[model samples]
Target: MRAEVGIKDAKVMGIGPAGEHMVHAAMLCNDYNHSASHSGGAIFGSKKLKAIVVHGTKRPPLHDKAALIEAGLRWRKTLQQYSVSDRYGVGHARHLEALPNNNMQSSLIADHNRGFDHNRVTQRPCFQCARLCPWDVEIGEGEFKGKIGHFNAGAEWLDTFWNLGVKGNATLYLAERINDLGIECGHFAFGAGVLFEAYEKGLVKAEDCDGLRLEWGNVEAIDKLLEMTARREGKWGNLIADGPLEVAEAIGGDAVKWVVHTKRGVPAMHDWRPHFSNMLREIVASGGMKPQGGGAANPPPDLKYREKWGPLDRDDPKGWPQSNVIAEQYRQFVGLMGGCWFAQMHLKPDGLNSVVDSFNATTGWNFTLDEAMLAGHRSAILQSVFATQRGWIADHDWQQVGQRFIDPVPDGKFKGFTIAKWLPEMVREYYQLSGRHEKTGRPFMNTLVQLGLEEFKEWAQLD
Candidate 1:
């Protein structure tokens, strides 16, 4: 469509999943992949036009949607006012507010939403399982005896194993055991759990484990892995700590490919590939974290809608579809703010659009959808500059829509659903709507220059 629309030259940019896709698609189209590093922006021409991509921070207050709305902000306006605080956290707010020359932090905060306080236990749901089971878990007996210590499953010896077989839900029981051990469960952080299960079954041993016991749901094993992870200890620990992808690569096994992650190293924890619809695009749009809820996905019991349309279609709020729309808008928001999404999720869906109010209050600008989209365009261009400078670009080196990625949901309830078969259409549709080249999957040169990429325009118009 970009070619059809007479958009001949432009420096294109993609960030997060969008950026990842751009890199892949550009490689496919042009047969190269060269993006800038995470820091510097790329310069395309003698004019020195730049494109930079800085993800929002992972922090609080700005992360909470309710607070953003309550504070009365639109997406762009909130980004402008709380740029640093939004991206980093409320803690960074002080740096932004300190004095005259400190606006750099403020600018960063504006590029992203504030992060959330994940350490605050009250903010999270109780993770404890209801039924009690026992394991011969070692506790600090003296100070923490029976105080709900890690792995309280007592030494009934084989009883736990017996129940596991009878219960037949090795996954469930294993999860419970790991949780009991106080392990942090993030995207596939339970890699240790799977390993522990294998170890108990004698499929793996201390020798196989690099001298550490891969005990069955053993808390000590978890502790060891955690410690190893912190220090990047040993070859095995170092590989696993980075993620299953690197682990698989180092181990020279198919383990990483089968571990279930996106093209990048991120684990597919939300189990997205199978869900039918453009929903998974949200995760694709996010670097890897499924914006709908990274760890595991759950249905929204109750969804409250804003009176008017902001970004997402508020009328239909389900899992996949609603999530896709929200994720796309979220991509736009975070990219423009150069902030992280960890904090963006904290803000309610409407919290961003309310930035209009915040803008009026702070900068005296009445922002509109057109203005917001333009900001999005500029943000995307900046991100492109960043990728180009980082040498993350190569002709046709973009992430391919893996048949497995776009096809069959490999590992969960929605196993048979195919994402690849349907997502291409969605991608094309997205491109069309955005006024981009359908074949190249890159925005036009005019669009780039419009978004402030003159140098990009010159290089893009090569020949």
Candidate 2:
């Protein structure tokens, strides 16, 4: 598409053949690696659109270019210090041993990354972004020899093994393949894991699986299934093509029990039976967008509202609500000035203040921490309002969570613990702290007025 348009640097975002068919887990891929949700692709397909290409030649005016540069320098320099200048790359802090395998039957796996490199030279930094997270790599001697893949997340290549019950270069190769095909990898991996578990448990036979063995780590079978999903081929393939919930339902007989999802989308694998704050993030997010709840667990020391929030307890929520609210507010505030969430997670608590200084310097709008936090809370409430209007009662929706996650961790560091015990209270706390109703999570009429979002009063049912 870029070649035809005569713009070599044209940014292209579009669907693949499967997405064009409007398959259930269809997704949009931009450039080489960046991707978005299933419905995003389905929407493009629904309108017979294949891709949107843009080539920007004009630079937008900045409030303070020099100040922004200085902020950028602080962002980079501080990250360099915090990273130990040595711990920057894919899977740097990853615990490959803790990867969930075989549909959460076990939370441990032998390291199977297959010579995956994490050298800074392999780093694929974004356009003037502070974090040196993403990576680009070339395969030298494998089934995928000579192929180079552009992967976005620091965990991009690794998540394949995390999601699929597989190992090694095949997982990396699979990531590139599906990325090219433009189907969301996490959704595809979840569907594959469910089928693998079902096959292991005899819920489905090879005959029923369209003649392919659905055993765990069967890369060939996994590849074939992905092909069928993209094209919606055969019974199992067509079923998977439909989407996670749909495919699990088609498999029937406890297959759905193996799924761990929210709002119909299967987020990337994290057996959060152990990580309470992480689970809280998944449960409370309006659209299941992974709400960066991990922010609460390792909050910046200098979070403006730190004095008000309590400490985080990994296995409990007594202090979770307030801490998470501050983290969420800070996250939204940082995002407004175009900051990276993942990068901040690694910073010293004091390093976060740099982001604030950067924001104020760039905008010449020196928003005190309190003023910015107010805006952040408003942004968050806006999401709650949207979810509330969708009939998403906070507590009720949690009951619909997949059993795989709600069940206690069978093994691993968080062994035998489940966030389920405190989830309802946690959700309620999250709502109350965010200025929503104590139980319903909807913004109160006056709360809306305080946030300058009174336009949502009627929609929030607080009119």
Best by lDDT: 2
Q: CA lDDT, every prediction?
A: 0.34, 0.67
Clashing pairs in 2: 24-242, 301-349
What's the lDDT of the predicted structure labeled candidate 1? 0.34
- 104-158 per-residue lDDT for model 2 (tens digits): 6776545656545432226656675556555566765567666676776545335
Q: How do the residues 1-463 of candidate 1 rate in per-residue lDDT, one tens digit apiece?
A: 2344344433333222112212111110110111221211111211233232233344433344455455443343323222211211322223322110110001111211111211111111112212122222222223223322122221111122221121112222333342322222221242343344445545555687867766543445544665554345676555544444454444443333333234443322222333333334532342322222211132211122322223333122223443333334435644554443422432444444554333334444555644664665555445544544544332212243222234353333344545454445554554444444544535477766676766666434222
Give the range where candidate 2 is weakest over 10 consecutive residues by summed lDDT. 81-90
TM-score of each: 0.48, 0.89
**Relative to the unseen true structure, what is the C-alpha lDDT of residue 15 in candidate 2, on a scale of 0 to 100?**
91
